[model samples]
Target: MTAPLLSVSEISKRYGAVVALEGVSLNVGAGEFFALLGPSGCGKTTLMRCIAGFETPDSGKLTLKSADLSGVPPHRRPVNMMFQSYALFPHLNVYENVAFGLRRKGEREEAIRARVSELLDMTQLAPFGARRINELSGGQRQRVALARALAPRPALLLLDEPLGALDRKLREETQFQLKEIQRKTRTSFVIVTHDQDEALAIADRIAVMRTGKVEQIAAPIEIYEKPATRFVAGFVGEMNFIEGEIARDDGAAFVTSFARLPRAECALPQGARATLGLRPERIEVSRDGEGVAGRVEDFVFRGEYTLLRVRVAPDVVLRVGAYDGRFAIGDDVKLTIAPDAGVLFAESE
Candidate 1:
């Protein structure tokens, strides 16, 4: 947000007839953990490659620390990339693998040793530096790759789904560890991920991309509570959408069939086509309540909570949460939308 650590200006890329990146532009601040989040084939990978100098853009400029990156090769740029596969050398021990880059840069052996030891200790790989890559668990191997990338202390570190290979439990734990290391090192990080939970849990800010363009760039809470587009609302979390036209009249706000929606959360023109976007937890389900009528159609037993699907209209089956087992399928119920809970988006967005 300050003078950016990295600046990407109107970058575009293509392959034959297909466009991989189209005028994508963003800025990464110093010591910020920024995330580029989207589904597969969304051009996040392409953008990362461009920053790493692995892929050149068809047009645009990239600058880091006020220095132009045009025509700069990957090795010459003050940036490092950690691949998803944890590209550790099988023949080298952990210490040697981490010290490889430093040695390549012609640092003295004593300085390389001290730096490698510090990094190994930081990543909790100090105890296993003498072991070969094959002898370590997946989590340990990941830490090794992370340490190797951080050894040189580059101004920017690019992580291409660095935890993709770890199991879910380990990945969750490592997320916090990664953040701690980034904090201690104070190095700017730009991570590429398709997992929404990962981005929300780890990033200082997120840029949600779709088909080569950034849809929204904001902190995790804003991206969830005030989505810039419908695609962002659907991609970030579990959301229910209902379409309607805005009406300022206190008398009639309906098309005669759907449940009455709350006042729009945003400013919209009178009679403009709009939509109500509410998260599942925003709706309260009860057997006898002063609200819209519906029936329990199905249920999903999620640990620590239960999810109920209530069909309130012919085509609208709103998913609401039910903590107790008081209701069953085919039971009549009332659905109440919490006051000041839903967000309104232009129907065309």
Candidate 2:
């Protein structure tokens, strides 16, 4: 149990009458990749800025290695931030941009040169070091920004949507690169992102926020498979929710839906109102009438798989993922789900 690299305790912030962060607290383990994830206005960015000294909390404390950092300035704190914009100096070449931080600290020219060269090589930018910032591609500039942020060798690095500027293909590629670089550097990273997929792809743990409070904090798989709330279940990925009340027939428990569903878990008592969550990919659709009957209302091909919207009831449309794309609109189909594929939560969860 090594001490956490950074600890935020009961931190709160406000903008005039608007509350930005409300008693948000969390710990960042040494060398861990953590993410603050939520949609806009969820207080994620505010918390990140508080850590970077760009914004001050109205109460609570921030600590680094057991020392308080209440009055520290941004540059004086043992942290650096990489903005979504990359923030590379237009007038400087890649090498000089990375060397900017070290040179500001009055390091000897030889030492600065050595560090800059090492970072460039590590980031795979050795061949592009002499090119100006405008000459580099979006991904190249992102690497340059990362190299510059890591140049100072700070205790922690804060990333505010580091990959938001790139196209989908490049963004996915850079996510792996970012994870690899973090592993190599072994520096604690706290990334703030609204992109759920990116956070799930890269973060060791994620804190899902909403309305200036944390909804849940856990590993990606846990958050997706065993969500703490209905919001978490719906937000992390695509889910089909069916509202029903628990019922008992003979010795077995079931939910009153268009098709009676066997209990997945026994936490809720019989007659209690609850919602059943089913992931699109977990459902199997067929035309042989092996399960609940439904009609294919519409579908869209998504390359690796196809999303079929099936109408089981007048108001209930369930989204199902089919790998074969064999069904078409107006086709009658049957949908079946494994007993353990569904999750049950209270109606108000």
Candidate 3:
């Protein structure tokens, strides 16, 4: 197997007393589309900045192709960042904006024009070569920024919320185009975004972050199906955190108990305090019957599926998705969690 393209080793960062990242280590393979995903203030941006050489880490090392990147200036590194704001030059037209970096490197005018035109054509912005930045739409401007960032043909590309500025429809369309571009160019892309759908749609692997730390890193489907922590389970998608105490472990299985549910099966773990995490969609809802009975507090008829807020207990209101059956508010429902689908997370962590 080929060596990893990038390896982050025990990297830590701090803004005074506030710890922004802690011993976070990850590896990215060549040509892989990696994503850093989390809500705001989770240090996702900080980690990306560290990788891009915009922010220096307090401890540990960053390596690209086994070479340390410490003290390497952002401009000197073989990595380029596409900012969230799409920092395109206002005065430069599309061609000039895309050619700016090539010119700075002292490339001949013919080479600059050729490369610029090629990228413009690739991004489908060739016809807008003479248009000023202000004349273009948000998606157009975004493509310009991408072309500029990719102009130098950097080995690794870091994108920070690159689609946040566009409308939903445009963003969705651009997402596919971005993925296609990456695939064709074979550039190692690292994108940071809080939009789960965007990350799931484009990324080869996602590093889910929370509170300055990485909660989990895996393919989107694996992250959704088997979350490593409670934070990850709740962050990636809607989940019901049912408080449960481990009743027994037979070295191969576990049992849990709650007031409304008894002996719920879980993965074997020798722990007393734990929480059962079940995804909303993993639950099967039916008329009040054998499973845990609950009264539907509210029902929303979404286009593809229905969302029900079920009051299972006085204090716990679990969100459940019903894709088939339609239930009215105050309707009694039976909530059943697939025994194999429920995940057990150790509460202490």
Candidate 4:
């Protein structure tokens, strides 16, 4: 395997009594699109600042390639960070904004012109180079910011909530553009975002953080289908968690709930407390009365699919995804899961 382009080993940071990052360690492969994902105050932004040299860690080390980056100034580090605000200078035109960093570094005017022109073309902003920053639309401003960040040709590019400034539709469109730009430049990107959908949509690998620590790190599908913990399963997407105890039926592990659920990966001993995570899409709903009984409580018609909330027991409500809204509220239904539908984890987790 090739060596990672960036490595963070046991990095920790604190502000007064607040803990921002606690022994966080991870690596970014060369040219890989990596994401630091979590809710607010989960240390993702702090970790990005540490990597960009804006905030120093209390302990541990950060290295780009093989060289240690400790005490390296932000401007000296071979990295550029794009802020969520897009931060383009209002007085400057798009071309001058993109050329700012190169000019600041004392690059020859000819080289700066070439680099800025190449970035503008690569970012699809060649025609808008002469436009004032205030005249560009939100998405255009975002592209300009990205182009400016790339002008220096850094080895790594860090983005903090890159699409936070745009509307949902534009953000989705820019996600593809960002991925394409990364592909063309082949620069390692570490994006910090609270939006799980955004991370899943663009990152090659996602590190899910919680309470100043990493909860899980894996590909999007693995993080969703086979979450390492209950928090990860619940946070990454919609999940129904059933509280139960592990029981053995014919030497096979099963979760004793409203119904016996056979799980192949249950490692706990018999009678151990556990939770079964069921994705809404994994549960099949039908009115044929062929599976566990439930009553539809409510439903939402999403364009692609319908989401139904069903009350299975007095205290248990499960969300089920169906292709159509065939069942209405107050309708009786049956829910069934595939043999390998759910993931099991300790209840304490």
- The candidate with the higher lDDT, 2 or 3, is 2
Q: Residue by residue across 1-349, what tens digits does model 1's lDDT show? A: 3589999999999999888999999999999999999999899999999999999999999999979999999999999999999889999999999999999999999999999999999999999999999999999999999999999989999999998999999999999999999999999999999999999999999999999999999999999998999999999988988777866676334221466665635478668887777898888888895998999999888876678888888988888877755678999998877547767777778
Error of 2 at 38 (Å): 0.4
Which structure is stronger by lDDT: 1 or 3? 1
lDDT for predicted candidate 1 compared with the true structure: 0.90
Candidate 1 vs candidate 4, lDDT winner: 4
Off by over 4 Å in 4: 251-253
Candidate 2 contains a number of clashing pairs equal to: 0
Each candidate: RMSD: 1.7, 1.3, 2.5, 1.3
C-alpha lDDT of residue 109 in model 1: 93
Cα lDDT tens digits, model 4, 92-185, are 9999999999989999999998998888898889999999998989999999999999988999999999899899999999999999999999
Q: How far out, in Å, is residue 311 in model 4?
A: 0.9
Per-model TM-score versus the true fold: 0.96, 0.97, 0.91, 0.97
Give the alpha carbon lDDT tens digit for every residue of 1-349 in model 3: 7889999988899999999999898999999999999999899899999999989999989999888898999988999999999989999999999999899999999899889988998999999999999999999999999999999999899999999989999999999999999998899999999999999899999999888888899999999888888888888878888776665433333343424333445544554777778888877899966777789999788789998999877877888999987899999988886557668877785
Local accuracy by lDDT, each model: 0.90, 0.91, 0.87, 0.91
Candidate 4 CA-lDDT value? 0.91
